[model samples]
Target: MGGPSENPELWAFLESLHLGETLSGTITAIERFGVFVALDDGPNHPVFPGVGFISIPELSWRRFEAASDVVQVGQRVSCEFLQLDTWNLEARLSLRATQPDPFQAFADRNAVGQKLRGHVTKLVPFGVFVQVANGIEGLIHLQELTWTPLKAPSDVVQVGDEVTVVVTQIDRELRRLVLSRRQASPDHL
Candidate 1:
């Protein structure tokens, strides 16, 4: 776990790797935390089932219920080499890197003030999440929910309700979309 710099052989192996490099491997194990992969030409993990490790968030950009929803044992996969986990003596890989980011795609095709029709997916104290595009959910903050002040998003909309919204702000770097329902309403205009 602590020998990458201390161990010359491991250091050389790590140096040979280039970030963002594509690596092919077979999924060896899937646990609650992550998935392990035996890279076709990678080094031994020493303690783990495989030398490559993929954290749950790195598995995909889309929201999923479980790791099994995205991958399975013995499944072959191609992932981008993220970095070496010196603490675990394993290479961190990212399956999401192998796929196009839906957030980025959504931002590219849309702009602020653009009106979009989406279904309310979730409600919270602060805001509501609406699926504005495939795999893209934007937050409509409490203040943006209606022209009239409301204590909670539930007062304005509930999950499964179809609503029209206007893109008020888009944070590309943060992968966030701020929406406003009041602005999109014909009565408000």
Candidate 2:
């Protein structure tokens, strides 16, 4: 209904590739959910050029405002094979896996207990999320929003507030960086 449907020869080709193998393709379409890739060396699907497909998180290592920021429809990309979406018969791929992670760039230059300034990106019931680095965020827990006890996170910080926070912990495995505004700010109350 969309691009093309599965055929016998195409099915045989798809069966030949193994997971984690590197493949080349052209970005044929970009949807809100992900980018569809037309493989240079692979067969086409009946519905899409999805011999390869890259999800939003798998598009790039940097924080991009949108998909167009990273690639265009005709752009070529070399991606690692993630898996085959059997239900849809699309090739699941990762573009970022081909390059270095920008989060590592932030980690390399920063450490725990260090004071850094960032803008509050979001305020939730649990904490304030701050963009300390491009695509990297640190959480200032509700209790850490101020030295004194607060009723809610909003009582201390609002969205888009430029705040200084101290790095409390960095969990690389989970890609989490914890921050404390209370530790960085002197108690005036």
Candidate 3:
């Protein structure tokens, strides 16, 4: 037995066990639960086999309403293995997990005044969740969502809409990412 990281060949072999490792594979089957990825790893690999599963929560690095929208049968994707159980032969992988944080890049790219494109993920009475990039979610508070007088934030934007936003604040210590749609779009006012 070899440590997962130590054994390059074994690591590569184990990585091929899941969907995200290598996108080159056929969708051997699809079921109500999830799609299956057929790899050249072994013979007789079951379609929806074993305890290994990529739950909806683990599917994306960012928050999404529907899992199916992000993935489908016969789609190729590269992913990073989060965990694996040799005993149970279970593997947990993530497509975005393997990628670097966009917010970090945002912070690096712009000091403060830079603009970014963000998609609405959640709408609340107080604010909205905007995905600036994969694994990077910024909050657009009711006050920040719009400059106009609004009774509710949802009036300005609905979930899944892409809007331009300005980086108002980035609190890495508190893990807070703040953006202002109002500032980003002055014409909207």
Best lDDT among the predictions, by candidate number: 1
lDDT string, candidate 1, 1-189, tens digits = 666555556556666888999999999999999999998887766678888899999999988989999999999999999997777777899999999999999999999999999999999889999999999999998988888889988876889999999999999998999999989985862
- What is the model-wide C-alpha lDDT for candidate 3? 0.64
Model 2, 1-189: lDDT tens per residue? Answer: 222243765666777789889999899999888999999988766777666889998998766788989999999899999886766767789999988776777888889999999999988988889998778888888888887888788887788889998999988777789999888877752
lDDT of 3 by residue, 10-98 (tens): 44555566444533344444454554444434333222442234556556555555656677766655555556655334455555666
Q: Rank the candidates by TM-score, best first.
A: 1, 2, 3
Report the lDDT of model 1 for residue 110: 98
Better structure of 1 and 3 per TM-score: 1
**C-alpha RMSD for every candidate:** 2.3, 3.3, 7.1
lDDT score for residue 158 of model 2? 82
Question: At residue 158, what lDDT does model 1 achieve?
Answer: 86
For all candidates in order, the CA lDDT equals 0.89, 0.84, 0.64
* True lDDT of residue 68, candidate 3: 69
Better of 1 and 2 by TM-score: 1
